[model samples]
Target: MLELQDAFARKFHYLRLSVTDVCNFRCQYCLPDGYRPDGRKSFLTLDEIRHITRAFAAMGTNKVRITGGEPSMRRDFTDIIEAVASTPGIRKVATTTNGYRMAERVADWRSAGLDAINVSLDSLDPRMFHQITGQNRFHEVMAGIDAAFTAGFEQVKVNTVLMRGLNDGELGEFLAWIKSSPIQLRFIELMQTGEMDELFERHHVRGAAIKEKLLEAGWQQRVRAHNDGPAEVFWHADYVGEIGLIMPYAQDFCASCNRLRVSALGKLHLCLFGEYGVDLRDLLQSPGQQAALQRRLREALADKKATHFLHQGHSGMTPHLASIGG
Candidate 1:
């Protein structure tokens, strides 16, 4: 049986897997100028990722999310999705993408039994979007989102990382757009990681400020809560879909964090803000290491910190969100 941690009674079963550390767009917050990995390394093969995921599923993991620098960038993304979706014990198979190439692959993704999609769309304004993501393919992302809807993705969640001076002014505009769309919009508080210091200096918007802005704009917050994730969700009375706030900085969710992260290289990260991870690639390579993998996983979970100190004003502590499977 999977042992439960005392810090948080919730049995840990969810895992976020990063398919690759390479992303098409260099978002300012995620990858600032002059940033590079220590050295070039090979990404986990499709078969390798599948093997580790299947082991985790067998060990009682039910939820799995495929993330990346951009999961869509992988040529065999659909194949990976199908493998995880077909896993017996896996209950949820989702992916977080920049949506640049989703339009062309939405149908393939949906047909592969992928559960849902979470697209990172920080701003709707073309120029602003380009400024934030450093990509001229904003239109492509929008089209991809439409394609996902057409492909019948059950719950298309839009993840917007809010920064104070950067896109905070557009919160109302985003909410207005969400009001008209069926997709759920989630506003995430800017945390101190990645190019966080510089990004924070440039944009770092807080959750409290966002909530105040919403309340002042005549948007009444409905009390209906959804999901066991970190996001504190609320609905607008006039809209069919709801808005969510993931306050990782203001109010930490580490205590109730049931998610674990697996990097593209096969390292397992217990928390989003954690500084270290355990390498599972070697274990996966050896049949004799199967039992060892489970034991290591449990050890990582037990060592999971109650909360991250990023909110407490730390630097160079955790890996970039993109590299760590944001």
Candidate 2:
């Protein structure tokens, strides 16, 4: 087993893979102008993705998440999912998508052994949804959620990145919807990255503040979900599902973070807030580079920063979330 440590001595094991930098929608938080589809030859081939996934799986990675500019947009998405799911040691095979295209493929995905899904749904209002995603497909996303549930993917997660002026006021409404549904709702603090400043201002809502608000609104915490990632999860006493807070900006989770990121082209990033990454694609192509690649990955983890320096009024040396899987 391979053990890698960050600056704070946290052991890393999870890997988030971005299979494509292309997406179907232009979410304000993800791609403001919609990601142009890179030529098919530019993205990582299924074989390359599987090779790197198998390599990491062999080195003690149990949790693997497929992300993208929007993972659902890829033509060979199911093949990639099956490849990762079939990797020997991967205990969890999850994916994050915009949810627009999931309705048609939910059964297909589940049949391929997908574990769970994290759907990005920012607003409930049609106009606001269109404004946020630059697409008029909110209804499609909602349908996709239903399809996922019908397909037996009961552990569906909804990720809502809370922007101050945009979707903060709708938290109660969104939470109410989540309470009525079977999916968990996760609210993420806006981070200062990509075109963050141009699109929305960082709200910096601390996890404590959010908890207080929920309490004041009569929602009681049930218990934290026993999971590996850093989100603080809570449940409403009267609700069917739970709520999660990903306080990356206000309260960093670097101390307990076990996640690493693999870019669409197969570069391994040790930290989401850091710019550095090791090219694993080269290793897959070379006959004798696997051992060296493992050493380089471990060394990168050893050098991981204790906390992202974004709160110091400076965005850390990290690539855009689309470029690096988030």
> Against the hidden true structure, what lDDT does model 1 obtain?
0.78
Best by TM-score: 2
Clashing pairs in 2: none
Q: Please, what is the TM-score per model?
A: 0.91, 0.91
Residue-wise C-alpha lDDT for candidate 1, range 1-326, written one tens digit per residue:
56434256656677788998878787877875523655768888987877778778877778788998888778999999998999888888888898988889889998997888889998989998988888888899899999998998756899998877778788668867878788789898777775467667667777877778667765565553222457766766787667788887665466567777889989987777777778888887754576788778777776777777775676334657787787
Clashes of 1: 2
Q: lDDT tens digits, residues 109-228, model 2?
A: 989879999999988898888888889999999999999999998678999877767777887798779777877888887777745655535454455678788778777655533235
Worst 10 residues of 2 by lDDT: 220-229
Q: How accurate locally is residue 197 in candidate 1, as Cα lDDT from 0 to 100?
A: 73
After superposition on all C-alphas, the RMSD of every candidate to the true structure, in Å, is 2.5, 2.3
